[model samples]
Target: MRNMLPAAITAIMSLSVLAACGTAGNESGKPADSGNSSTAPAASSAAGAGGNASIKGKVTFLTNRTDMVDKEYKEYAKRFKEKYPNAEIEFEAVRDYDKTLKVRISSGDFPDIVLVPTIPNADLPKYFAPLDDLGLNDKIYFKDYKATGGKTYGIASGASTVGIVYNKKAFQAAGITAIPKTLDELYAAMDKLKAKGIVPLASNFKDKWPLQSWVYDLPPAIAGTANVANDRIKSDAPYTLDGAYAKSFGILKNLHQKGYLEPDINSTNWEQSKKDVASGKFAMYLLGNWVINQVIENGAKSEDIGFFPMPYDNSGKINSPLNPDWFYAVNKNSKNAETAKAFVKWMIEDSGFDKFAGFIPVLKDKQPELAQLTEFKSFNPTFIEGVPDNDQAIATQNKAQIDPPAMVQDFVLGDGKAVFDKFNKQWADAKKSLGY
Candidate 1:
């Protein structure tokens, strides 16, 4: 689930104010030589407010989206250099980036500006530099997503909401009159779809990560609160049959029990399921708004694909989980601190990353033109506020070490009560090992 999984960091933050630092250049505009000398930014005294700060040094940017690297980010760099021409940006891709980043963090070998991962709110200060000092709070949206004690350490390029991606034509074919707004209504719609010989939901259990939608994505809508996940982490038996965790999982269990899921769920994969929904073989799938374009690109008619908030409660007021894919964080130990900070400021304030990245713009009055996101907003979904989970608490499951998705997959295979029981014990053990 990209929603909660720790992610790679993003760009921009300038160097500290220097009195008389000189502009330095390397052969071929590469990173300057680190001669164990002063690592402060080379800001010229001639530069003042609104004037270009002479920053020269290599800032390494690590990202998981190599596609964006050659396309969108290449443009971002060109615009960035318009101000600090001396700065050189070196790009690197760490495969399985989120997991590899953890290894790099443990080894003290992380890059200068990482695409900041879901490193949990409690651990933000340990790995990132606070951006509030740069006055980012008043400038950026969702500043509180990664803040603690009034210090903002991470800022997102954009935001996304977890919702159900469905085929609009399929609902019309099933003679369904309205979109579901509650768990009971969703089940009722499923019954209508099933009656007309259509799969009500697509569960890509073989890949497993998609199953995390039920665990982490759906519950916030059900509880009408974003704190459900963090709250469960602090609860005694998070997987009990009657708990909120179960209530959310209960939605999946009900789908399986009622024969509303796609056939042979355990063997299904995400790619084929995308086509299935496109072809009207499946009606809906639980995922973030990001998947809407992908589904359309996979040959689903763009107009036929619509997104709605996940309705897990009868409150008639559903809350879509708002998630920032990754935040741009400056590495505190970097030699080019001022330049890095400058880069961050440029990215947050000047770069048109939202349009290029196709995300919900986090800037004030800056709205996205993506129809899926616009459709989601039409529902007037409620937003939730909660603390970010520390790596120690969130890592075990997100890594698929304990594999909550696999457990849900087992529930699909059979014997859900046993699986929930086992999960409760394991979850408690994992949390206890972290002394919480």
Candidate 2:
């Protein structure tokens, strides 16, 4: 699912001056190194104004948080302007951010700053300005997520770990005294909730994207492999019956078969699901930690909502994947290149957007203060930071038309084995045709 953020706070009284950053290379697959540090470029004046005080100009920032554009985003712009009184930041919030941004990118008419979409790493320089001069490489996590040839193109805005966002009131009402630490315990808790006439979990099947967590995000933690996507590139039949894909999907399937999911799956609504969970009509949602704030905003008391890693198995050991949320990047063609770069830097460092959005800070030295995150840490789950998808792995999945979420929908609605067999065949054929 797409991400969302909340309103901004007061502007920082003191802001650091940043040097103008430059893009090192073009679309040709040449190294983007800026002839300074291997991971970042030396400060240069070619891109924009060199300091926050000197920064001036207007830049439009493209964002996915359409819900916050009118009020919250305006507050962000207001705070930003306090630091750079001469600079103006206009937000262009799109409901369908990835699709719209892709079209804008194809037409070479995107905004100055954007939440980097799902384009390949090799294509970064083709559209984005090098962010090396932001001097964030050494200080941030996932600095290399969008980097190639030692030059960073994007900086992660924040990080999240997928887990069960549950209502504590529902758990207490159902007499679930202990947090479920294993798959069996989770199912038992679901039974207790169901017996109390509550929807045990929200399938969110109709939304499609939320179902993706079961296949894309949960499997890595289930399999205890951080680089599972790249690891799949080595196998034509990555969807074996005994594989992590099967195990992860099976958990959701079991929920469906046992009637632990919401009734009338075809009519499930994402927005309503949040409200239902918040109101304790639904016990849980298997989603990222980011959803905690959304649930609270929908009326769940902050203390009533808690998060824990998904227990995909009964082993009691939990491995959660710590994944970055959308990355922030500067457009290569922005007329206000320096201003755009400065805005991106300011958003990352000074905006306080990460904490407000309930995400783990991308800055390595910073820690999230969310109570849910503190509770999650108490579980002592091994965190597996995500590995970037290999270009070839992505290519193979595209060629094979393997939509993990859709596969999950098929599993719950139709036959699980048949769905896997069909995809496995397509994957093998695609691999053979690609000579891999």
Candidate 3:
């Protein structure tokens, strides 16, 4: 249940711009002296730009892989190092990452490559560099999506499938014989687990957004079904979050009222909750590939975990949505923009695509091992074909609305009867307002 939840805001975004901004060291020793301060990057002597005369400059990256204390993103960083042996690549793991990214953009000291954060549209434009002007157009895989998202802004570092992750051992122990195919079954299964004294759902509510993903992640699949007009789910359409979200909420609320979600779900620490399930105390969680990695690595036998495709719209039918894991971007201001582009090219095209780094690469060849946790293949979609090609329209119609605005989160976090009453009235009003 909680494993299906998205991690943190900063953790997920910066990995896409992994080569970009990182922790900034106040190494000038001139710190704590003035208000107008700046972080001077450690210099490198490596050659860059068409094999220039000893290119020695630092490319700061923003990441939290600092836990890999001894091992850096050694592979990709190593290649960049060889190309510019004299350059000292200073990898910075910024604390309070969301704020740090904003500070850099304001200080005129932005990272060479910065992540285009999904921050509800507040700070995206200034930090993101458009790939179109760089001639990266021809090389990108989604030529169908070429002109779509306005700016080629940046490419996702990798992609993942979003769904519910369950403990196979827990399910077996609880004597629950099948994965829940629809909302009702999911509730009934949770009830069965509760009777056994097992917490049916576990997640880090403190991290906040993990809970948020429940609200946001699922709308795209159900809403995408009508494939609505102008690529938009009509304001009057029955399946839009306005229509469907409350219904989803009602389902989740039914679970909560029955005590399926853990008491104090908000109190759980993210790492520990995930570990708890991997350790087999909690039975279910919602998550994507990242959680799968944790379950497998944490001593859980390979066959012991189940990743469920969430049941949406009461239909019990499977409709998986694409989860964009991460994307890459070039610094518009860099003097060696072409070489930077070349570096991005090397990542997705050659060894970069299939290499087992911390991420699941999106390129065509060698993808990280996409393991199936259950017999339900539809829970994990393999392609983006036959889907509405509009990017924001797709997000608006399907995903963004899923959690709170959509049905998923409301059922988990809000007043169920209230959400239903409110949205249902809103939908009815919209029909009249549309004058149809």
Top lDDT: which candidate number?
Answer: 2
Please, what are the lDDT tens digits per residue for candidate 1 over residues 222-256?
A: 66666666666666466666665677677787898
Order of quality (TM-score)? 2, 1, 3
Task: Give lDDT per model, in order.
Answer: 0.66, 0.75, 0.49
Indicate which candidate wins on TM-score: 2
Model 2: lDDT to the true structure:
0.75
Per-residue accuracy of model 3 over 168-222 as CA lDDT, tens digit each: 8788778889888877788778777778778887755445555544444454455
Which 10 successive residues of model 1 have the least lDDT summed? 10-19
TM-score of 3: 0.65
Q: For model 2, how does the per-residue alpha-carbon lDDT over 1-436 read when each residue is reduced to its tens digit? A: 2221111100100111001111111112121221221222226443234545557789999897765677667877887787778899999887546657877897998889998876667888999999887766777777777888789888888877888999999999999999999999999999999999999998799877788688768888887776676777798788878888888888888899899998988888987998999999999999887778778877888889888888888888998877788899999988888788877777767666665677766765454546786677668787666778686776677678676678888887888788888988998899888888
The superposed Cα distance between candidate 2 and the true structure at residue 207, in angstroms, equals: 1.6
Count of residue pairs whose backbone atoms collide, per candidate:
24, 1, 47
Candidates arranged by lDDT, highest first: 2, 1, 3
- Give the CA lDDT, 0 to 100, for residue 401 in model 3: 28
* C-alpha TM-score for every candidate: 0.73, 0.85, 0.65
Candidate 3: 10-residue stretch with minimal lDDT:
27-36
